[model samples]
Target: MKLTIYFDGQFYAGLVEIETSDCYYAYRHLFGKEPKNEEVLYFVNHELLGLIENKSGSATRSSEVKQRPINPKRLQRLAAKESQKTSLSTKAELALKQSYEEKKKKKQMNKREFMEQQKTHKRQLKIMKRKAKHKGR
Candidate 1:
């Protein structure tokens, strides 16, 4: 597979071979180092960029590939796909946010409970010390 990556508005076209660990990392290696986040969306073919923004999949290059006018029907389909992705991402973000808040709240509650127990133990120890002193009298 080949992809064109955008780095700060500049385009670099290269081949992306698959690996066992990570697909993105395989492509990043071609850049001589790890690629930055912004470079992930670069398209190997400039024309595909327009189609992809409205759609989720990549355009495959074939030997018989011909240059022709883009179909309006395809564009419509792509737009629909984009809308679906937006909704999915929004839901995922909300779920993650709620999970983080719950974790934080639980941690705070545990800490408060621990501190209260410590205070109670200290008070009990103080009372025991006073009783011993009174017994000596």
Candidate 2:
């Protein structure tokens, strides 16, 4: 298979025909040295950029990654996706806030409220403490 070699996705040194993906022949041909365990084809620094098709066989660039041109389509898609995600999160927070307000309104009890709720709260705390002790927590 033909692979376009790159250095940090920037320094493009054209393409070369290789017998296989991770073979010694390709590594030696591109890097001009035998491949190491760490600096293999798919590893850091030494990377097999991409495959060159017989029809569209052109991979030419030597600039750094930051200097490369951005695809407009990809940027537009990302912007739209981010906007949708932000909108959904905002809606969820609004719904949560509305529920919280409703609950707060319902819980606005008078001074002469039921003593049963206070009793039940004390009972629940006691039960929680007892369960914790029983479980050796």
Among the numbered candidates, top TM-score falls to 1
Off by over 4 Å in 2: 1-112
- Give, for candidate 1, the lowest lDDT window spanning 10 residues: 20-29
- Report the Cα lDDT for candidate 1: 0.58
> What lDDT score is found at residue 58 in candidate 1?
35
lDDT of 2 by residue, 1-137 (tens): 55455543323343454443332223312444444555554543344443322323333333321246779999999999988884333568999988998887767653225566788899999999999999999
lDDT values, one for every candidate? 0.58, 0.53
TM-score per prediction, in order, is: 0.34, 0.19
lDDT of 2 at 60: 31
RMSD over all Cα atoms, model 1: 15.0
Backbone clash pairs in model 1 (N, Cα, C under 3 Å; residues 3+ apart or in different chains), count: 3
RMSD of each: 15.0, 19.6
| Clash count, predicted structure 2 | 0
Q: lDDT by residue for model 1 over 1-137, one digit each (tens)?
A: 44554343343434443222222222332343446554544433453444434533433344334458879999899999988884333568989988999999999999999999999999999999999999995
